[model samples]
Target: MAASSAVEPTSFDPSKAYKEWEVNGKYFGDGREVALLDYIYNHPDIEQLRGNPEKILRAIDAFAQSVTGLINIGENKGVIVSDVIAQHKPEVVLELGGYIGFSAIMFGSAMKRAGGKQYYSVEKSPLFAAVATSLIDLAGLRDTVRVVVGTGAEGIQRLYDNGLLRSQIGMAFFDHHKPSYTADLKLCERLGLIGKGTVLVADNMILPGNPPYVEWVRASVEDKRAMDKAAQEKGNPNLQYNSRFVKSFEPSGMEDALEITECLGIEGA
Candidate 1:
């Protein structure tokens, strides 16, 4: 890995604690996503939500706050990625998860505003993907975003096989299975989806730390090469990365952070 990137600003206010009901529990797949859609579609301000990402996001936030809590990359952490998008101006943004299309709509809107072409939200659950597609279409971003239903690796391969993601992936966002973060990233590395100038944003660093993924991104190139023999997957050890830990608040008001890693270049090429 390359030298770590310097964290910025160095100033942050105390974030409010999440409401007791705001944190997620073992209550997914109970049609909460559908309830969110119902709430949005039935709102008196539904007309104003059309083609309005902000309003749509507000509606989602409203559902999460007033209703059941959703496990999403909430407004706080979301802004961090949007700032990254503004700086990188990636032509395409790929997300490993798209729970109910919250992050998809949020970041997809940012990508479009930044003059990017596409934002791909890959969700393994077909049900969630369907719900996301409906919400994304409702946001009138059907052209700017697409929801792929499959595992992260499958999603990458499907896109690559179809030639929609042949060149370097401008940005990759990881917010899926905690343990698979490194494995999925390695798959992308193997497929050459990630390259120089690529930005990788991974969620759930503090709340549920991922040492393997963080170690891989923060390791020295020589260290990575040495560790390659013990790895289960064969990612390019030569891909140099510059990582930074950006602290932020989870939607539940719990302290969390995103690991923003940039592929500076391949090492010893």
Candidate 2:
């Protein structure tokens, strides 16, 4: 007996761990986690606390966060736009794309706080507009915010025809289809709807990306640079323009998703 051969046993399993390293390795920002957790913690209790005004506002914020989380776990551009509008205390606000009333609720809340501000939201989807209208009513902001079912371009015409666009729009929010951003802004400009010192905010500049509009703005600014230089040479102050980028949390890193650019017309300039 040659010292009995050592026996060894090997363990085997039919199913192997198909580990997705990237999926499991992804990390969320603390801010994103907090926003998502708060949304989750509050959303389910919204209906139960609907009657209270403070709770309703919190619920609206949570609902907006929930909707945002469905696609991207981050702070919403609408909320940022609303905050800017509120800070400016604009008398009139025009919004393109009212989706499920999230932006509308944010805008309405800002308007309510600003006092005497009115919001006009144009949405191309009738179903979305209907939902927005219902939500507006539920939020008790029907009197402050109006949701119109139509593309902003068409809706602007209708509003003008209806005598609603005659007033100078102080702030405009562009959050609709990315391609339509520049066209809609031009349309409003051609109509002379935006007043001097008007603030125009464009969202989804990073993730969904609006390079065309961004490039156009850059080109326009570059072209203006020569004129500005000439103006400075002529003893006139160099023409000045500014844009502010608002950052949003991304799984990878912080990204700018919103561009809040103010257009200072001749009067304001």
Candidate 3:
């Protein structure tokens, strides 16, 4: 499949900038996440945020902007994924990362709005998962989004083995460990969870780009077959993908991209 680039120039609004998250050689996991819960619950308008997804999102954004920096898929990049959800209307959405439940609440609400069913958010850190669970429940998305704590591969396997992911996933979002992106995707393919109509949206493509994953998705079936011969983590080589690069900005106003890929079909099916 041919690669395409959709560029929409966006300038970060200085007024909306979040507090510098990086401090004294630390980015996250310095008790800030738990503090975020306290901040949200104690917000003067806390009642206004309850059961309101957008409002809760605003509250989270407020905390990030005024209190501390959060490693999240900010509203800017979030719109791109939401647009994809609106168009595709995936019934079951799988998110590889559920950091503090930002994307889970955002995308889970989007999925529900688009007539989708379940949204499974797999988070690696239990503490992060707990934080995400609370926020997601606050957004009134507990029924739509389910958080499973484990690494990408482990979570995928658990879901699949338990029949929660027995069929192909409608959409899968990758925002976990960068190195696990390709391997986890391969596992999905091998398990028959990535078939025609599957939409894969991978974040952090520009800040810390993933060349290997990009190359794998954009490769021709013939090229992929060649790659699988030597690859330890083998995916379905016959799967065809039309991948593209979408230029957007992070919530922090930093330039970033989401590699959006749509599986066309099996090559010989």
lDDT of 1 by residue, 1-269 (tens): 45554354323334422234423455467778788889999999999999898999988887877778778788888889999999999999999989899999999999998999999999999999998999899999999999999999899889999999888888999999888899999988988988999999999988888999999999988898888878878888999999998888787777788999999999876
Which candidate leads the pack in TM-score? 3
**Candidate 2 deviant stretches above 4 angstroms:** 1-79, 218-241, 250-256, 267-269
Name model 1 segments beyond 4 Å from true: 5-25
Q: For model 1, what is the error of residue 14's alpha carbon versus the real structure, in angstroms, after optimal superposition?
A: 10
- Model 3 spans with C-alpha error above 4 angstroms: none
Per-residue CA lDDT of model 2 for 1-269, tens digit only, reads: 00111122122221221112133344222243344334533566756544233455455444433333322222344456667877777777888877656666676677668874688999897766775676567667888889988998898778878988885677888877778887777667656676556777777777677875554333344454454464322211121235655665332233446766665443224
Q: Per-prediction RMSD in angstroms?
A: 2.4, 17.0, 0.9
Task: List the candidates' TM-scores in order.
Answer: 0.93, 0.67, 0.98
Candidate lDDT (C-alpha), each: 0.87, 0.59, 0.92
Q: What is the TM-score of candidate 3?
A: 0.98
Better of 1 and 3 by lDDT: 3
Per residue, candidate 3 scores C-alpha lDDT tens digits across 1-269 of 64767777577787877778797888889999999999998989988898999998889999899888999998888988999999999999999989899999999999999999999999999999999999999888999999999999999999999999988989999999999999999999999999999999999998899999999999999999999999999999899999989988877777899999999989889
Best-first order by TM-score: 3, 1, 2
